[model samples]
Target: MTTPLPQKSFHDVRQALLARQEIALVDVREEDPFAQAHPLFAANFSAGRIEIEAWNRIPRRDTAIVVLDNGEGLAEPAARTLQNLGYTDVALLAGGLQGWIDAGGEIFKDVNVPSKAFGELVESQRHTPSLSAEEVKALIDQKADVVVLDARRFDEYQTMSIPTGISVPGAELVLRAQALAPNPQTRIIVNCAGRTRSIIGTQSLVNAGIPNPVSALRNGTIGWKLAGQVLDHGAERQGRALTEKTSADAARQARAVADRAGVQRAQPADLAAFQAEAGRTTYRFDVRTAEEFSAGHLPGFLNTPGGQLVQETDVSAPVRGARIVLADTDGDGGVRANMTASWLAQMGWDVWVLDGSPAADWSETGQPAAAVPPPEGHTEWISPAQLSTWLQGDTAAETVVLDMTTSVNYVKRHIPGAWYISRTDLADALAKVPKAQRYVLTCGSSLLARYAVADVARLTGAEVFVLKGGTAAWITEKLPLEHGETHLASPRTDRYRRPYEGTDSPREAMQGYLDWEFGLVDQLGRDGTHGFRVI
Candidate 1:
């Protein structure tokens, strides 16, 4: 018989947050529903993705973790999974997500609530300067001495950007703002897909004491669209490299800001000491541009560009009270790491920046390899060519194919007649699909699908084979593709469409997103556990 797991009440979790004690409040639901409503710091750990993401997210096996689920029935199984995977202190919430609601815990909408709310807090406290989208448009129309910087990812900038704006992500603002607008007479405006990045990026410039007058493009591209202003698509503009003196100066200013925010500086010895503490969870990250990190980075340090690190802190460091160390090879002080540390410190993290300059031998290169567990059980595999032939012929009726790729990818391109399902939800999802004499599973690379082979084989009581190389292999063979929601065996709970994203967000939604962000400062106050402070 299984032993009953320990349970933590809503008061227990709140106390831990308020006291700055270590506790990970994990929501074991998929992203879509989790985004719709959850407690402020509850990190989303989807039931299907536990194996692939757990090790990196919660590095310390003994760290306290509280798993919660609504009516989804995932919490207990997830807690068991964590225990099986060597997590020693995993438990269930006292009454689950519903319990939290009943106990008066705040339910927040959207992903990255902690970071987004902190951005709002920063703006409210500092009263960061801003220019309306209309005003920025007029400046551009008049060919005024103004430079606009987009503080989002480059692909996001390319999709749609303010006219004459160049990509300069949040952390890069301090490092490159002066280079883009050297003249003090020039006005600098920072914009993002929405408000968070712009507010943070604009404040970063102000914190660094950049000579040019800096302000955020009020409400960003959404505001531009709302104001009936046009945007430039496929913009490839970027800021130039900074000189050694300029880089050093930026680092100094960033370090000062981080100091004001109470960020700690760690030498190599200090990092070693922190990692040696068995009771603590330490996350080491290389906070540089992906391209720069790929060229070379320190061993054992995962690469998450600084701007993205701030935006997705919950994803990167799920253990709420863990210690985070940021690294960058930006000369001695590392402007990127320092600036990133400042924001993280304000967001209530015990963040550190490496003090010493990196040595010549930065050994590791390329993206960090994923740690995928071996498949559930041994199974035969069918090649893409063979599967394609079967699909075109009579055997198609006897064979059923399952696609475990993300819904977004499944919608873009997938095998003809392939049904998409979340592997973790297979039991319920499989009942929807017609059973056949044989079953086949495939994902982007067959990496995740192979794990589902045993599950499907047992469920159907039929011959099961994994598609070799998965869907990518089929695409490589130039096989015919089908798009959209062709055969969905499961609800598309893997993705949550953001209110501020895409070409045609309803005007109401865009305004509502802004309105939600505007009220976050008050929400944070009412929640009272964030511990955020703007310097």
Candidate 2:
């Protein structure tokens, strides 16, 4: 038998790390757990991503690596996997992460890595004056000079954010901060689900060289809920402040920003004219958070969060030459939209921002008014009655029914014979979906189902249909609903759990898997390999 690799003690690893030795401390934990607590130097490497993403994460083979897991028996195998990948100096931590902590060694909290740390810093400094739910309600009553920045992801902000807080994700802080307050003296605050992001985000600006004092919304909205503060929903946040700048003023500012960035400003009439123009690929993007986008955005506008749009323009708008129009709410929304427009212009795209703020009422603007059409080439519209008929008809042997709802709903109940596809996994699933068969898309609501139908149709050119009113409607009608398998990926076989979904597998396993997958993709790109596509 081959000789077993030697293990290193916590003291040995600590000494090595403190000496500034070239080392990569990999915490084999799930992101959520890892986020809560981790070694200051530890980077996450889930087993699920090992094959695909790990290599790219740990590029230097010479750097000594110490892998850790929570009392779970993953540390040894994970180290071995690294060794197999040609990492010459890999070892397992003595007793995994807990062992390190138990050894009376110092553990670091809030060790936000580069990009995410940078995002947190932005939230800390620029996205400031966030109010707790109760505080915000009080502010509304008091009419204070404070502006609440919903530092959570846009979708979350849209779904249920403090009514006063405008959606501005953590990453967009640097670019949009200046426009958000305009007046440097205006108190700015940042908030998230809990204290971590809000606290760290507020601190980031303090760390940055920005000339502003910032603070976090204490405990975020959760604290507000605990305090029994009520949250406003739907059209409550849409009402415009009568005393604030008029829509015309906001439009003029938007036009000026667009002009400065060398982007065209599309007035309502111009948009109508552009829509009428033939053969031009025009993509309307509501560059807001998902929640806001979902909470009644322009018909036909795709929800591409501003920060994501800036970072992943190629994926968001694959058509390089297409005209892109972005919309956001007033203040923070305009800031993000204008910032993205600036970047698109720099990249040689014909970009534009909608002339005015995204108010509740856009009906007065003579812009092209039309419902968001189903994805191009999607000819089939299945009614509730037609679904049974369609299900009965033999379409293909491998027809996949993908439910893109929240994991909780998927776990509670889903369409019979449907494979659950969480939103996070949509892109990956879309890529792997067989081209030969039709795809059926459903969600908690009809809107998401319709969107997925359009998306899959666009990406795969697959014959797709949306389940009208979605699973909620189906459940209400007392239609059949199948309970999804408790474990989608076998823990024994796959070695990792799906991160976003609930799974029996350890968090370290999932992180390792993702790290491996990312590494593989990087290697493939470096080797000039192609044809195998990621959704």
Candidate 3:
């Protein structure tokens, strides 16, 4: 029999949150189930992803971590994994997610609750101005002096957008708004796929004191669609470039906003000090476009576009009480990092903007690869061509392919006849697969699959092989790929489908999502653990 892991009561975790002590309230289930219900601050770190994600996200092995699941049996394996990963302080929530409910903790739904809730709270306190979707549409129809700025990512803008909107993702809004709308009389409209980014983006310009009038398109694209407006598909309007003068002026305004929001400015020495702190978890992020970061950036800083970083804080920095240090290559000053830090500070983070020019040796370029722990034992790997030949062989009937990629990716495409399996739950998933003489493991890069090879070999006592390049390499080899969920060994709990994502969400669900956002402020108040304060 297994000894139960040490546990923390709901009060214990809540106290850590309220006291602003370093604690990670982690839910080990996949996002789909986690989003259905969890404490307001619970960060989802699915059991299977701990090895790849925990080090970068939590950063400090000694930080208190309380893992929970709604009786899904994922927490125990995850806690053990954390311990194996050299995490010194790992524990379980006393009664799982149920304990929080039993203790009268306020449960919240959907992902990025902290950031989304903060957006709602900001609007509630600041009363950030907004115009109805219909009102904005009339302005566009009249060819009025207005430029709609989509606060979503560029790809999202391309998927669908307002007829004449420009892609100026959240963090870029302040830095580029002036150049995009030079005339002081132009009405600036900000929008996103949903309310949070729209509210935050518009409020950013307002707080930065942009001269032109600005307002969020109320409820964003969902509202636009509900109002019977036709969204343009495949729109590709980018935010206009800024001249030196405009960039410098924007930097000055951004600094002022950061100052007003109490964001601390940090130099390299200060950042070095932050890195040397043994007991604290500090995330160093370069808040710039990934391409810019790839060209060159300060060492030890991860690339997280400022907009997405703010939108998905729970994922980017799951250690709720950890310190965050943001760096940017904005000219004259760290405009992007400053603007991002201002919002983070208001969201109750101890954040700093690393300012000034990066030295020549800030020459470290490219994104850091996930440092996946290697497999305990090795398995033979076959090239895509070899696998293709084997699949066409007479004994192919006895060979089973296990695809360990995300369910969504698996649904979209996979190796022909591959059985989808949640690697963390492989033992049980194996029962659903046919008895076979050979088993193969493959994922996106085969990096994740490589780790699973040893586990599969141990479980099935069969000849297990890993695809050398994963599914990506197979596709690159011009092999035929299969689509759809042909065989699922485990449930598709890897991701949560947001009502605001994609263009095909049901109208009822869209309205329901909007209604959910409306109540977030009250929920935040009741929870009383968030340290958010809008300036």
Best by TM-score: 3
Residue 397: error of model 1 in Å? 2.0
Q: After superposition, how far is residue 216 of candidate 3 from its true place, in Å?
A: 0.3
Q: For model 3, how does the per-residue alpha-carbon lDDT over 49-119 read when each residue is reduced to its tens digit?
A: 78878887888889999999999798988999998888989999999999889998999999999999999
How do the residues 78-143 of candidate 2 rate in per-residue lDDT, one tens digit apiece? 677667767777778887777877876545433232223323333433454545557556766787
User: Ranking under TM-score, best-scoring first?
Assistant: 3, 1, 2
lDDT per model, in order?
0.89, 0.56, 0.89
Model 1: how far is 145 from its true place, Å? 0.6
How big is the positional error of residue 311 in model 2, measured in Å on the Cα after superposition? 16
- Candidate 1 lDDT tens digits, 189-218: 999988889999999989888889989999
User: Least lDDT summed over 10 consecutive residues: which range in candidate 1?
Assistant: 355-364
- The TM-score of candidate 3 is 0.98
List the pairs of residues colliding in candidate 1.
none
Q: Mark the regions of model 1 whose C-alpha exceeds 4 Å error after superposition.
A: none
Candidate 1 RMSD to the real structure: 1.5
lDDT for model 2 comes to: 0.56
TM-score of each: 0.97, 0.45, 0.98
